[model samples]
Target: MNNIFVYCEVTEERSIADVSLELLSKGRKLADDLKVKLEAVVMGHKVTKLEALLYPFGVDVIHYADDEKLFPYTTLPHTAVIIELFKKEQPGIVLFGATSIGRDLAPRVASALRCGLTADCTSLEIGDHFDNKTQTEYKNLLYQIRPAFGGNIIATIINPETRPQMATVREGVMKKEVYSVKYKGKLNKIDAKSILKDDDFAVTIIERHLEKSKIDIKNAQVVIAGGYGVGSKENFQLLFDLAEVLGAQVGASRAAVDAGFAEHERQVGQTGVTVRPKLYIACGISGAVQHRAGMDQSAQIISINTDINAPISHIADYTITGNVADVIPRMIKYYKKNSK
Candidate 1:
């Protein structure tokens, strides 16, 4: 375990994706544990100029593969470049953010490399110690923990025999390292690929359109989300009232979102945006691991549900047992009464 490599999937505008920094933070810890260098790999058109943004995260190396063919993120060509880099670096641990691009790219890279890759890992650790160091075989070691059975259990997966142990983690699950104005690191520019572009694959992205939301839940400071237990779509209006009072955005669980109670952008879970807001109010939302995977990193979590035994109640910093519709009106009344 000499090197920890992270994928820096960026937008065309040169803005580094948040998930990349999250990976760097997790990678920094793993690198320190294994006494290795942490490297950030950026592949896109004219990406070499963005190296200044990466060094502040405390990454040791920045490998930029600036190629025209990689700008739009095609499958075969991008996968080919990543495979070439992995073969050359042979890093001990490789991490990709469980984003739209990562979800598609990671598998291809892993398949090309012929190694095991765990997807949507919520927790990661390194330097796992064995009970019998000398007598125990080196095969059954190294733990990768993820939520299973709808987030009821934390399953620790192991891939001892694989080189470059790979995993894809959701954004915001790990903290982002703060930037330093004076920090400096090395960057290397990769030459253009010898082969020209070929669009022979069955899948090619035709167009991408950004959704228009009243408020961007991903970057919202405060989020008030509800679930099926919120009663009905009409009852869910209380969530918005509370959100307005608190200057917060509204979010919903997959169950509620899929049922047309809320829009997809407001949904928070493994399938939705990973948010680390200052405060998250989970109203009537059960503490499913999938939902927790998105907002567990919020600075403060307030759970409101009638059932004290609800799974989310245990993880919340504050819990109130009452109907969402009932408790919400009380909350609105309290907030309004306290206001001057």
Candidate 2:
């Protein structure tokens, strides 16, 4: 209960990932509630420069492991560094972003330490629970909340017995905020060379191809999502047109993705990426429970569907009853005319 640690993932651009900062922002609140310090575990080669970014996000101390072998994120060395740090520090709560690297590393470390790990958590909080069976009270437990049963129900998981409660949160599930300038923190450099050995690296990365992605729906300020009602792959262009006018990204429900109307990466739902955009325009989507679980957290929802009784209408801030093809062109025209 001394410190809350966040595993900061460094990008190939030598910058800290946005998800890491988001975790730190949430971890800060948890640390405050627990009266503990908020710490971050940063690992990469020449990553000392990125420490400055961690300070504003409520990080009190940084456990840094800077080494060439740490870059590109091989499982063994990175896991070794994290495991060694956990053994030495014994942090209270450890958080990881449910990204590719986080998903891979968290389970390994949790298994090694014989601790419990909650994956794809949407929300986290500190609270107490009364065990009626034991007639016992557990205080200050980390509540790992996530969608369960194919997003039909929500489940809150707790690791009451574990020393360092661990959870992997999907990106964009939490908001990122910076503390006031009055707050400042310190960093502690770790020697990873001594802890790692030649045999530890069972796998090697001969070459790495970093492809720049075209769509970043998770971080988009405005997202326009389509479903089966959008019709065919060619008709999906209507979504793109609206998105271009709004300076937004295009997203699709699992149905649209599966029907070949959109690429899998453009999917937004339980089986796909979760988004909490400022404005979510769900066009032609029925708002299935699975899709709702991903985007129901948006600040504002505008659902457009011909069916007045569409499930999305229940959660939508504004419901437009119309065909997407007919409605979208008019919207684009109105925006273009008004802006001019």
Candidate 3:
């Protein structure tokens, strides 16, 4: 009830995961709203240069648990550490990255403590809730919002009676920002032996191999996206051409992927990678709510579709009414002409 805690995940490269940094950025704002300190729990082996990495995100205190067994992130060891620390701290809110590790660890911790845990939350906000059944008014509850009912409606969930309301958020959903470069925070080192047991080390990693994806649209500054309306796999080449001309990445809606117009990695929507590019160009996209949830945060959005009344037009800064075949090449030519 005193602080907001973010469970920071460590990458294979021994750096903090991007999602953890993003959570810290969001946690800082939530902590400010609740008038509480933003704390981070970082567990890894030989992890160094943390203050240089985390403090500027407005973290007030850090629980650094360093041990050789912690780096690889086993379910039992990580869960035991978090549960032990949480029992001692009794945090007001706890956040985790909706990653493989988070998916494995958060539920265990929540079950151990009997706390409510929300997963893949698209948004987090602090608000008041009134329980009509109990006639009770609760203040400053974490609103865990996500697409529900087959992505038809957005649901806002709350844990009014649970201690340390917890939620796991997807990467790229929240923007990562720096609070202040000069800000500093305190660190509390935890001894692994006191908190861990022989059972915690029941699972051991003999070897680990990582395969990185070639497509990285999440960090693209400019994105050119297409939908089922893009017509065919051959027509999607126009998006790639336009992207090439503008130095942008090519993205596709789930429909386009389902129709085999693009690779699965290139899909952008609730079920795909979320992006916040400087510029987003949607070609022949109908713009469903799920798709909008992913790229609506882009700095500027341009929708190109024959349907002028399409849902995407509502959020697009500019909407072009035309066929994708006709509009895309002209856009490519215009940008290529201007750049030269």
lDDT of each: 0.81, 0.89, 0.92
lDDT of 1: 0.81
Weakest 10 consecutive residues, lDDT, candidate 2? 47-56
What does the lDDT come to for candidate 2? Answer: 0.89
Question: Worst 10-residue stretch by lDDT in candidate 1?
Answer: 133-142
Q: What is candidate 2's lDDT per residue for 279-336, written digit by digit as tens?
A: 9999999988778878998999998899999989999999999999989999899989
Best by lDDT: 3
**Model 3: per-residue lDDT, tens digit, 94-206?**
99998889888999999999999998889999999999999999999999998877667999999999888999988888899999999899999999879899999889999
What's the lDDT for candidate 3? Answer: 0.92
TM-score of 2: 0.91
TM-score for each predicted model, relative to the true structure: 0.88, 0.91, 0.90
Reference-based TM-score, model 1: 0.88
Clashes of each: 0, 0, 0
